[model samples]
Target: MPQYKLIYFKTTGVSEFVRYLFSYADQDFEDVRHDITTWSKFKPETPYGVLPILEIDGKTYHQSLAIGRYLAKEFNLTGSNTLEDLEIDSMVDTINDYRILFSQYLWETNEDTRAKQKEQLVQEKIPFYLTRFENRVKANGGYFFGAKLTWADLFFVSLKPYVDFTIGFDTLKNHVALAEHAKKINAIPNIKKWLDTRPTECCIQEFLDAKHKD
Candidate 1:
């Protein structure tokens, strides 16, 4: 088996994308979870002071996006040329910006404060970004930026809870185009089969379920 390992906390929002990528590509990987104490002990092995690191072929890699790009190449999910890859990179970057402000820092604010943040994100940011991407999807006539099913498309389709866990709020369910975009990407036969057979992802689905509960 190819030795693909990812060290991460129990949360899935960050790690889940890569896991989904690997699984969809039918790549076998080891996902090791670390609590804070375990992470402190493991830090020396990390190139940086980060919990999420990927190891392949006894070589370690850092930076979440870099890992994504690496896996994209391995699976042939990145675009063909430099410009195409740049466009894919651009879309992923925008989503990352939202994640840094919202998902990563979500629980830090009080409920009332977070509600206002959520309102702004849902009312303005969500529609604006999704609509822009929808236009891009229309432009590409199928995919996000590369005129094909790139890793960036998978990344966005997997991102359903950036603003709010509720499909209506975070995902803009009213926007049929964006919804269809997500559905079409995920519903690809190979992806759907792989998803059904794959082991449960620890953090991502759990978080979505938990959000629905609260």
Candidate 2:
């Protein structure tokens, strides 16, 4: 019964960003999850006909990213200043760019092409982005963006597992810098505790099954 509450689909796609914030902050909130059969009813309640809605102290937070930023800033997660925030936003944008292809791959029907796309990701996109991100890490003085672990860092850190193995940033192997970032995030005591006790989501396996189904 914390001040913020999040409503999202049972699946992980859209709401996870907000989820990471609350979890990292060790804040409490109501989690309302709706299945497909329940989405029609759930959709209309949101500001933009979306499922993932954040209500802060009973007021509604419409956009997902806005909500994440708000919560992050409130809990000392965002950057120290506008410049740092911009860097964090840039990293977030990079991940968002790749997510476009992720959505495309999710709905694509062709079998051979999908596999080929995955391979392409593994070869050109994965390594390229990973290297680019790795370089960006060094350029920005290590971590994701700021010297301190901001919300942006937590958000991407929360997402690193999926990236290292999923369609977005999944080209990691002997990636020293990137792996170091991941390791650092993993070592956060609060995060470590949450990871140990968090509930399971089947959508992870579902994503794999759906992609490889062809």
Best model per lDDT: 1
Q: 1-214 in candidate 1: lDDT tens per residue? A: 6699887866555666787788778778887886545666877877777757898877888888889988898899887888878978888888777566566335433667777776776678767777777788888867777567888888877656434543234365666777788888779776687557655434444444445556
How far residue 14's Cα lies from its native spot in candidate 1, in Å, is 2.1
> Candidate 2, residues 107-185: lDDT per residue as tens digits?
5667788898888766677677668878877776677765567665666566555554456444445588877776787
Off by over 4 Å in 2: 161-170, 204-214
Candidate 2 least-lDDT 10 residues? 163-172
- For residue 177, model 2's alpha carbon misses the true position, in angstroms, by 1.7
Q: How many residue pairs clash in each candidate?
A: 0, 1
In angstroms, give how far residue 79 of model 1 lies from its true place: 2.0
lDDT of each: 0.72, 0.68
**Candidate 1: 10-residue stretch with minimal lDDT:** 161-170
**What is the Cα-based TM-score of model 2?**
0.81
Name the lDDT of candidate 2: 0.68
Candidate 1 overall lDDT versus native: 0.72
How close to the true structure is residue 200 of candidate 1, measured as C-alpha lDDT?
49
Residue 34, candidate 2: C-alpha displacement in angstroms? 2.5
